[model samples]
Target chain A: MTPLDFVVSLALISVAAGVLGSLVGLGGGVVIVPVLTIFYGVNIRLAIGASIVSVIATSSGAAAAYVRERMTNLRAGMFLEVATTTGALSGAYLATLLPERFLFAFFGVVLAYSSVITYRKRHEDQLLAVSNDRIANYFNLHGSYYDEAEGREITYKVSGTKLGLVLMYIAGLVSALLGIGSGALKVPAMDGAMHLPMKVSTATSNFMIGVTAAASAGVYFIRGQIDPIIAAPVAAGVLLGATFGARVLGRITSRTIRLLFVGVLVVISLEMLQKGLFP
Target chain B: MMTRQSPGPDPQKNVTPEGDLQVSGRHRNLSPAQVAAMEEKIRKIEFAISLVLRVGVILSVSVIAIGLGVMFYHHGDYTSITGHASYKTLTSRSTPFPHSLGQLRRSLVHGDGRGIVVLGVFLLILTPILRVAVGVVSFFYEKDVPMALVTLFVLVVLIASFFLAGL
Candidate 1:
């Protein structure tokens, strides 16, 4: 396709991905990249470049609303950024050493595995944990929220600092090697291990992604992988999508939507394996 | 805290259902302070809603602007505009009109779309994984750590994905 055609198509994809990502809080760039590269025949490097822009665009955009609602734990995110960024830096460095085939194979496997787990936990039965932590205490991570359903104030804490940091390290590695946000990793670590509530995890993860991306995006940039042409639109589109998604988050059943999204990932992972093996 | 619940008719539809329009049917003995406190609570919720609205608007605008900017630059090619030390210069091989932009023209060139595909795929897997973190952060902010911790379990598969897929 002509560059114009490519960009126009990309815009359409961005909106769709944004809607999907925001609706599910999964950010479009992650899904958009695979679709562009594996299905549409776009180059992965170009996809990453575009996804970077999209990442910034979506997170920043969505973050605005999240912050206003007091849902986004900006401080927690910024503080933990220390660990996540460090992990991402190391991952980025490691990515250069791994063979392309290995990287591709590895990413494909992660997608497959996550999809299965998502399928298993696609319900409202989920709960949260309220615990103590030096990091959370020092950062004043404990806070209260107005639960709209209960029409009452529900306060919580920033538990599992050490565990969260460990997950962040892994998250950083994946992000660096794959150009994906470590939020997936970070959210679970904080929420499950530390017993944080879901909203805090989601918002905190959103707040932290930029730093994680920054850590590795720079590495990728230096590796001559960040093509502005690609990065600009994807990033812009993702940003838009993310912002829109955040605004509408309250309007939809993100949990259910996310579950369905996991199903889609399974197919994607399988396709990647098939192609990788066959081609 | 989001005081602005969905615009549904169920529970949080209106902030003040009876502003000074008190019902006299019940004993007409309710204290003014009680009524005033309820109204005050609603007002606080309204303020929270307003704050959320403000943030939402900015978020949407930025997303669109940034997405389009990236696309436009990508369409035009950032090499010509950013002028960063690393941008690849556009040559006849990479650009049809190598000399059309005069001084703003890109002088270096080389790109691999496969790299983009790799990046995209990597990012695709990342969204869900990273989203979990955001969910946790949101929980903490909302003082809903209970839910946050439960959702954290979702990361098990994400972690599995990392090791199994090598991401």
Candidate 2:
């Protein structure tokens, strides 16, 4: 194919990835990596570089709208970021020491378990009316948003602040080690552990992933793994798609969002399992 | 969904209006006016952060799009570029791209497509870091000192990651 054809086709595929990614709070890396390597025959390193670019693209693109809409729990996100960033710093070191297959298999099981939990809670939006978590209270992590689908303002309390921080650290570590954004882990940490409303968890997760990814992006850039031609179309396409997804998110019900997230979680778990068992 | 009532005989009922400013486990008792004021403050912070993110994405994507155009104009087709032996070596994993700021500057001066695209990617990577910096400033503006410190710590760690990568 001509260069233009490759660019256009890759861009189109990335748009789809971006849409699904932003909607579910997973970055486009999950789709971009395999597609680039398997279909386009791009080098694995370059594909990862492109995936990194797309992760940031999807996050920043979608998060801009989520924050503006007040769907994102910004304080919770920022606070959790403290843990994620630190986890990433250590994960970078651990990446060289740990066995990849074992880590993948372990994380896969964790995701599968979380997916089940998420599925069971799909119909129920867990917006706690009161939380006694002192850490969350002191940090002012509680939030409220106008749910377009429910057509009412939903105010919620945040709980499990300590647990949320622990999970976020693991999420950051996994993403750094695996070279994927790992928003799947982040969503569950907020939704299940912290009792954030489904939309708030998704939006807040979306807001935080960019910062986590950016922490490693500089390294990838310096290493020259980021191929310009491969990343250009992917970044631009994902940005467009994520922007569109962010707009659609507010209109959708929390139940629908939870269901979609559960589906993605199952698929990601399966993929992780395959990589672990097969590799 | 069942709306659960606050579990106690509401201490907030007799509390003075100044109680609204005190940190609490639940914000359920804030009067509508206080809620509005709080929401306004939060909105301003969100707006600032959102604006930063939106601007960053737009700027980076525009540069990348322009870079793609330049690439196509220069090379015409992927096949022709690959036909050259140098192209093979250039695309290999072992050989890194012009990634540093100085190299980027030189390449842009010459209007190199790949260099321009890398610059865009660089900008894209910087966006989230910029957003975190904005977060620190926003928290400071709100007089949320502890949260500001937390954000600053994250920012410090992020900058530290770059140096760690070098090691």
Candidate 3:
């Protein structure tokens, strides 16, 4: 493809990835990096730079609605941001040290792990029944949100605050290292460990991702990893696609949709592993 | 140190048919004064958060879109001169453009499409930082001293990373 064609193709593919990602709640960065690296034969660093920008784009766009609706737990999100941002900085520095093969392998492993976890938990929506911890209680890391579909308010108390913080650090590390938003990890940290409702966890995760991504994105920007030619189309496409996805999210029954995307992720993960092992 | 009962997954049982759910969800059984204060504070903070996110995304996407369009329009000129249409050649063959903030601004002032795209991505990065900054102020206003400090600390680390990138 010509450079113009390559750029346009990336944008169109990113739009599809964004749509599928939002539909499955995974964000476009996961798919974009692989497609750019494996399919388009773009340099991995450039792909990562573009993917990270797209993550930030989708986050900021979706966050406006989530925060405005109060579905996002701002206090919890901000509290967690401390750990995530710090971890992101560390990860960004580490990314500079790791070789391309290691980065690819790590990305593949994380993707496979995420797909499996998402698969196993696909049907499980039961909130964790853990007693509130002292740290969580002290921080008031508990809240409620109204579910429009259910048409009622669901109040929840967050627990496992220390565990959640630790997991968030890992999530931030993976986010910067892999150039994805790490929502797959953050959602589980909030939902599985912290006992937040699924809706709240997803919304809060979306809210926090932009901060985590920004921490590393700044480093990447300064390091000159971010290519504006690549980033522009990807950002615009993901933003538009995510916006469309958000509109249809509440209307769709997400189980089948989630499973289908998990399949896609599995394939992509394998491709990443093959590339890493071969290259 | 107020303690509120946690509602279950099935929200129907916790809420009354008479619409107590709205009241409960809105204030978590706080007193009238506390509820009023919390609502006002939440309203103000949410407005700020939403405004920041909306403006940031809109402005950045618009700038990037325009930049992409300009780059597409000039594709012939760029490819004709360079004899190739690959991103690597365009970006890496030259000394690579806009290594610093000053360079980006100067290029943007000259209506360079790539520079504008860089500025757009830069703005996109700034949105979350702005959100964190807003979080600090909102938390302080809510009298949540610890969270305000937490956000401030995060912001510092973020900026520190930017400087530390050189190392």
Instruction: Give the chain B TM-score achieved by candidate 1.
Output: 0.34
Q: DockQ numbers for every candidate?
A: 0.05, 0.39, 0.36
Candidate 2, residue A189: the lDDT equals 91
Q: Which number leads on lDDT?
A: 2
- Point to the candidate with the largest TM-score: 2
TM-scores vs. true structure, each candidate:
0.60, 0.88, 0.83
Candidate number with greatest DockQ: 2
> Candidate 3 on A149-191: residue-level lDDT in tens?
6676666667788988998998888788767637767876786
Off by over 4 Å in 2: B1-45, B79-96
TM-score, model 1 to reference: 0.60
- Lowest-scoring 10 consecutive residues by lDDT in candidate 1 chain A? A123-132
Candidate 3 ranges beyond 4 A from true positions: A23-25, A96-114, A128-130, A253-261, A264-272, B1-30, B73-88, B91-95
Docking outcome class, model 1:
incorrect
lDDT of 3 by residue, B1-167 (tens): 01112122123323445755422222234566765566666666677777877898899988888887776676664434344555556534243766577888898888888888888888888888888888777777766666678889998987787677652
